[model samples]
Each structure stands twice: as structure tokens, then as C-alpha cells.
Target: MSASCPISRDSESIKKLVDNNIGGVVAKTISITPALVPRPSIAIVDRGLGRFYVLNTVKPGEIRVESTDHLNVRFIYSILNAESWSDISFEHYLEREYPIAIKYCRENNVRFFASIGYKPEELSILGPRVEKIGVDAIEFSTHYIGRDYKPIVDSAKALRESVSIPIFAKISPFTPNISELVRELEKIGVDGIVATNTIGPALSIDVETGLPILGGSYGYGWMSGPALKPLSLAIVAEIARNTKLPVIGVGGIVRGVDVIEYFMVGASAVQLCSIALIEGPGVFKRILSEVEYWLKTHGYSSILDIKGISLKYLKPEPRRTWSTPPVVDEKKCIGCGFCQQVCVYDAVKIDLIGNKRIASIDQTKCYGCGLCTTICPTRAIRFLEQDLFI
Candidate 1:
């Protein structure tokens, strides 16, 4: 019994010594700078909008993902087929499209935005699904083909009030006083406005068969891609000039240059439908890369710097006349005779004996249309500056 008591007392003394030593060491280390301590490699995962996280033991050579909100891309669900209206169940269609869009956004690191079909009542069903999938925003078609905008605006306001997510209203170009409509929407506390949904029941007819392309007035579909760039620019420029709310530019964005143009006109972001449909999703990567390259070349750190650069230069100026039409180099000309055939006014003549085609512009007949320059296969012709008024 005496021997056991000694062992117990010895253990207690040892514990006291260890605690005192540890306390002394901690006190002495208090003056050590944090920078002197080696830290474990941390992986930073960015989920956008000032959100990030640190992960221990990051994989080798992992690239840190940066936020791309400044160059945000929105996916537009343009109803290409009427079956989407009735034949397909709305719930099923939404389910299919939502996953496709969400996956695309996740892979590309861009925001997902969609316009619900133009029915107000359908929002009760569609809105929940969109929000459930973590969609950043939802857009509503505010202007019907021939209907007044009052009902659309009212419905949009109601939806905006009901939904927790941001609401956008896509206004048509045909709407009278579109700027006024945008202002009214802003007053209703809408998150954003998309201007000029589609131009109108655009028509293309086969002259030989004398028939409509889509049959029986397909009613105006949205015009987009290269052809609509100028129109989109004008609409976006107007909205940018007037409104304080964010503007999402759509229509006719085919290349990175187009995207820059839209931003210059005051679009917070740009959306593309037709170009994606025409060129496929791969176009997004090309566009993004080209945009980044252009930004770097122009000494810009971000897209924000170049945005609205053209606003100051928007004032109208007198048009200048070219001094002369383009002249073809006789030595470089291969005598293809393409320019001769393209000239409508017989301004170009091919000298078969000399084996050389000479283009002599008769000032009276020459309209300066530049049709010949376009027909030249070789880069032998260029428009020389001319100061003639047609």
C-alpha cells in the first residue's frame, strides 16, 4: 500500500511540470509574427459574387477560378417550334430546358437567365421551378405582336412583386413610346429590362414558287445575329441614355466585337440566340477568348473600361463622300472577267486581244455602288477615296 501511494504522487507531479512548461513556451511564442509560420497550401473555390472558400490539400496544378460576372452571358430560350406552346407539357419542357441551361452555366461559369412564355398565369407554375434551380433571373415578354402594352406591364409588375428572384420584362420595338414603358417598369421595381424583343412578322418569299417560307404569317419572330446588330445597338443605346436600371442587350451578337459594341452602348450583359443556334455552343469559348485578347490588346483590365466608350461619340455628323472608287491593279488582275459581268452599267470592259481587262468608270454612269469591288476574287481592287456626291 505504501509503494502504490508513491507512484500516484509521482504521476501528479509530472503532470504539473508538463502544464507549467507548456504555458511558459506559449507565453514566449506570443511575440512571433504570423508570417514566419508556414501555412498549408489552400485551394480557393470561387462561387462568384464575392463568395469563396478555402480547401486543404488542393490537387496539383489546379487553376483558381475567378469571378466572371462582369462578362456575364445569358441563355435565351427562343420558342422555335409552336409545339412548345401546346403539344409539349410546360412542366416537362421547363424541366428539360432548365437542366440543359444549368449544366451549360456550370460548365462555362456564366449566369443562367430565361424568358418564360408570354402567359401571366403560367408564372405560378414556372416561377417556382426556375427559382428552385437557382436561376439568377427570369424575363417575361411584355409586348405581344399586336396587343397593347398596358396588360403586359401590369402582369409583369404583379409577377415581380410575387417572385423572390429578379424579374425582367422583354419589350417589343413596336410599342409606342418604348422608353416610357421602360420607365414605368422601373417604377414598378423590376430588376431589369430587355429592349426590342423582335422586329416583326419578317417575311421571306420564294419568287419562283411564290410561297411564304414558314407558311401563313409566322407572325414576328425575334430578329437576331449579324443582321440585327445595328438595331440592337440603337435600342440599347437609347435605354442606356435614359434608364438607371440594368439593360441586357439581345439580338445580332455574332462575334466578340459585337459583344464589345453592345457594352459600349450601355448593356450590363449580352445574350445570344441565333448565333448559338447557327454556330453551336463552341462559339461561346471563341467569343470569350477573343474578347479577352482584345481587352488585353487595348490595355483594359476588364470589360467595364471599354463599356460606353462610344456614348460621347454618338452625336450625328455629316457624311463624307469618297474621293474615288477603287481601282484594280492591271498587273495583279488575272483576267477572271468577274468584275465585267458584275457591273450592271457596263462600266468594265475586257479586251480579249490584249488579254487584259480595263475598268474605266464613266462618271455619268458610275453610281459608286462598289458592286465591282465586291465581285473581285483577288485582293487586286480597293476603294480609292473619292469626293463625289451621288
Candidate 2:
């Protein structure tokens, strides 16, 4: 957890998350001084519209995981938040926050990780103090650090020198030469990596007033949620393929299938923040139950059974030179004519089979675009070449 999550801000809030059935928690990123956060700091964007929910009036414990029904993916689900670092001072965390987290996490057998910032001076001060407090590990955020990357490497080196426990570098997706960066961190003795912070200083504006929704200067804020999944998946795969260090995936995870996808691409574990902000602490319990049910039903004893399974399937270039058209399964086709609407090449056609309708592809006109295969409501259209997988 980083900015804007109250659960990571203080001991009491942290306890709520601990009570949920989760194995670990990363405290919000703390700094030397509390941040002067802007008002109206958070906004939820759905399908090109911005919504402001009265989350404060509803107590955290009382809030259910209902808003994120299937991860709020029915629309273009995303969050634009201008939140800064932890509002509480670093000294306060040392005195009260860290101790409370450590105690509760200890009682619950949950691993607690302290996420610190990139200031070299601050790292020198905060790293040892939190380490001495007996945190399982330390995660240093590289979010605010610029594109140069030298400062991040330097700070990681200094932090590695200061702490005895594992040091996880939480890297931003925007960082250049990400694979090279993770290798450098590994060389410097950083223990592991957290792939992807939120994507972009993104923007969302109110159509009614023509004003920015978020309160940050110029109303720019980082975006996190379902929209971040595809980009995060590629980056996590890249980092995992590049380094031996355990990679923890964060960004757009709300379902058990999402966790399974991360593991397939090589995530040792995942962090849920954007979903938690909307779903509250109960989100953890809901997601864990889903994951357990899925694992058991799929006949997997553990997540380790599928870890990094997709890596071996990666091909640098296409194996086939020619494009193959998709086949239509007449039995499964509902004949909704939806596929015909999406086929840009005018390749799909609806035919009346007895009293029912079915979709058929004109192989010559298809051009193997594959749009119909994906857009088909039923599992009717598929590539003939994909039969091997079945």
C-alpha cells in the first residue's frame, strides 16, 4: 500500500486489514514529514465518467465488497487519486504506527513490510529504525523518482547497506529500462521486486462543470484499477524473466483469476490497494475465499503448481507464417449476429439453420482478424489451429 489508503496510515486502520484473511500487508509509504494532501484527493472513474462516493460516512468495517462486483469491470473501471505519502510523520510511525502494526501482525502471523520513500537522507534515517522495529521486510517506493534511474539505484544501494532484512524495490511502470533496473537492484543485493506502481499522472474531468475532478495541481493523478491489468501483466512478465528475485505484482487485481494470471506470468504474490479502497477490508476475505475455491476445483494443491507456467509459452516471433481463419461451432452459436457487427472485413455472416440462427465465417474474406472469435458472445468462433490446446 502507498498513498491514500487509510488502512496503511495508522495502527488501528492496519488492524482492520490484519483481521481479514490475508498473509501480509505493506504499510503506506512514510516520509520524514507528513504530506500536505489536497482536498477531494480521490475520484473514481467509470466508463469515461467520474463518480464521487460518500465513503467516509460509511464506516470502513461496515462497507461491503459490493461496489466492485466482478472488480467493477462492467464499465471502464479506474481511480484517479492525487494522494501524497503517509500523512503521519515518520517519527510517529516509529513511536506508534509501526509498533502497533508489528504487534497486531505478530499476533495474527501476518508479515508486515514497511514502504519507505526515495530520499537518500530519509532512507539513511528510516531504514534502520523500521528494521530495528522488526518488520519482516522493507519496500522502498521509486514512484516520485524521475526517469534518470541513477538516484533510485543509489538509494537502493544505501538502503541495502543499512538494513539486514529483505529490501523490496517497488518500481513504477513508467521507469525506463525496467528489466535492466531490476538486474541492477539484484546486483546491489536488493532481495525482491514489486512490479508496477499506478499508471500515469492521468486525468479525469467533470463533464457538467468542465472542471477537473481530482484536487491535485492541474488535477493530475495516478490511475489504478482494471485498466492497469494488461500493462502490468507484461511488465511483471518482463521483470520475472529478467531476474531471479521474487516478484510481487500490484495493479488491477480483484479476482481469483487475476491472481492466477499473475502467477502464470511469474508473480510470487500480489498486492491489492485500488480494489481495497473501494471494497474495504472485506475485499481480502472475499478474494481469498475465491482463490481457495478456484484452486480446489481446478485440482491444484497450491499456487506454486502454476507459477511461471506461461513463461515457457512465450515466443519471440510468430511460429506460423500464414494466417488461419477461425472455425464456427454451429452447436454453440446462438446466431445473435453480434459477430457480424464486429468483423471489419465483412467476413462473418449469419445463416438460418432450421429454426435457429448460426454464425459462419467466409474464409476467403476473413483475413484472420480474429475479432469475431473474441467478440462472439457464445464460445462459437475459434481458430482451427487452436484445437491442439483443447
Candidate 3:
């Protein structure tokens, strides 16, 4: 260092020159304040979205969107679609079908009850195995052959003696004295009674071919669905009036309304078959959903609250005096002779010359079953209830 000559000032001048040169050589970079990025899409999720996405369109604290506890209805899966007494083995069908139904019930938390219809010796094979599944109950199909109550009572007794699980007897509606059968079943310590199997070894005939659909004299089959509700209700009400054992009603149940109807008639629970066959296994979920919706809408907390509620208003009127047979409106009649062909009582006769079918109501023979109303092509027949009219 020869001399110290204001190097600090010179250094400041150099820095200024460098800054000016940089500014002139290139455009000055703008100071970049961090920009606020648009907020990411907020996804509002619901608890029910775990299985399927349930949108939160429904408001919280909304009474219409309230959750309901499921009803305690036992689902019994029958192996056969219709009654077939051919080479069909109930055990074989049970072995193949029961596992599928059991898996479904387990996954859904639904109770499954297996029904065995064979003789005591035949059902004995399944006894040990079924006892291990811890099913709700093992029901013995008592209506396999007919309305004879002796065999059913004996079977129930045998089953109860053999297994620790509860035994239920499924009986037919065609029994002359259903109350007697129920009383006998209760006396023998039966756990429950499933009232009414599908009506008939019913046959249907194709008049043109004069042959049965399933290869028999009578080709017609038992009517199910909405048509059998009234009959089921009557039987359930009758049994409820007489017996103390829990009655499980089965017939023509399609919807939650039908279930409620059966409950009102004093059924502890109701079973569905035709609806399940027509719709599928998923029909059970739909029925439960609708039932829960109905219960909540009606301000009912539990299904027990509505059971037998209709019976209180039910007044018994004299059968002969209050019930009347089908009356055909001649004005609406088309002379198709469908009514004459359908009458089981043979009460309708057609005048070939007049081209008119006349219905004579035989009070002694007409049990007011209303089979005629179903087959009438023209909506001419109407049942007049004397009590309701009064």
C-alpha cells in the first residue's frame, strides 16, 4: 500500500456504477409479494359415506333425515320355490342353499331361520349340524302334506326333545280347527307357530289343451301376493285371539304397510316369500327401509307400539248375518262366463239362450272366501258387509 486514497469513497462509486449498469443492462426485477393461492375445494363428508358416498345436501338436525334402528324381523329362506314332492331332497337343498343364506344373514346382521319339511327320520340328519349354527330357530314345516295336526305336534315335541334351540311349527291355513292345532302346539311346549303356508296343492288347467301346467289334473296354483292379505289377516287375528304363543304370519306381504297390517292383526313378526321371489333378496332391505320410514313418520319409537293396535277397534259381527256373498252388477256384466268357470261352489249358472251368466248366492255353501272376485274378468262382483253398511 503506497498511499490510502479514499478507497471507501471509490468503492461506493464502483458499487453505484455497478448498480446503474445492472439497472440499464436489464429490466429491474419487480419485488414479488407472495400471492394468496385459491383455497382447495372443500369436501364435506357424511358418516354414511364410508360404504357409498352420501352427499351432505341434507341439513343437520332435520327431522326428515333422522336415522332409524332396524326392525327385528327374521328372514327365513325356503329352498324350493313351490311345493314339489318329486325326487327333491330337503337335505340336499339345505346343504347347498343354507350356507349362502347364512353368509348373507351374517354380513347383514339379519337373523336366518332354516325350515325342514321332511319326516322325522329325514330331518334327523340335519339336526346335529343345524344345532351348531346358532340360528334363531329351526322351524318344522307342518303343512307339507295337509292340515292333520297330530303329526306336526309329534314332530314339534321330538325336535324340542332333541335340540336345545327353539322349535317352531309352520301350519296350513286350510286346517278345519287352527285354534285346536295352536292349542295343542302350545300344550306341547312349542316355542312359536308360523301360521299359514302357501294355500293348495292348487292346480291350474289350460282349458284349450285340458292339461296342467306342471303336468297334473289341476294346472292352477295357489294365489299369492296382495290377493292373500285379507285371508292371512283373518287367520292371524283368529289365532291371536285364541293362542298365547307367538304367531309368525306369512302370506301376501309385499310392503311395509303389509307388515304393519299383519302386526296389527297380532303377529309377532311377518314372513315374506312371493315378494322376495318376485323382487329378490334385496327386497328385505327395501321393506325394512320403508318400514322404518313409516314408523318415524307416524311418530312411533318401536314396532311394538303399533302391534295389535287395529284389534282394539275391531268389532266382531255375526258371520252369517253380517257377511254377504258376491253380487254381480248386471249392467257391468259382459256375459264372458268367467265368473261361472271360477266359482268353486258352482253357484253361478249361465243361460245360453239369454247369453247371460246369473250368480245365485248359496248362503250355506258360500264361506265368503271371495275367490270369485279375483277371477271376474269384468269388475261386476262386490261383497256387501252388513255391519259396515249399518
Best by lDDT: 2
Of the candidates shown, which would achieve the greatest TM-score relative to the real structure?
2
TM-score for predicted model 3 compared with the true structure: 0.57
lDDT string for model 1 (164-283, tens) is: 888877666666666777788888888887765555445443458774433333421333345566777888888787788888787766667778888888888776545544454455
Q: Give the worst 10-residue stretch by lDDT in candidate 2.
A: 51-60
Write down the worst ten-residue block by lDDT for model 3. Answer: 23-32
Model 2 scores what on Cα lDDT? 0.80
TM-score winner between candidates 2 and 3: 2
Off by over 4 Å in 2: 1-4, 48-74, 143-146, 319-321, 329-337, 350-357, 376-380, 384-390
- Whole-model lDDT values for every prediction: 0.54, 0.80, 0.54
lDDT of 3 by residue, 75-187 (tens): 32111122222232434434553455455444554454555544555445555556665455676664355546677777776677777777777766676687887888888
Kindly list the per-residue Cα lDDT of model 2 for residues 156-228, writing each as its tens digit.
9889988899998887877888889989999999999887788778998899999899888898988888888
Ranking by TM-score: 2, 1, 3
Q: TM-score of model 2 relative to the true fold?
A: 0.86
RMSD of each: 23.3, 6.5, 29.5
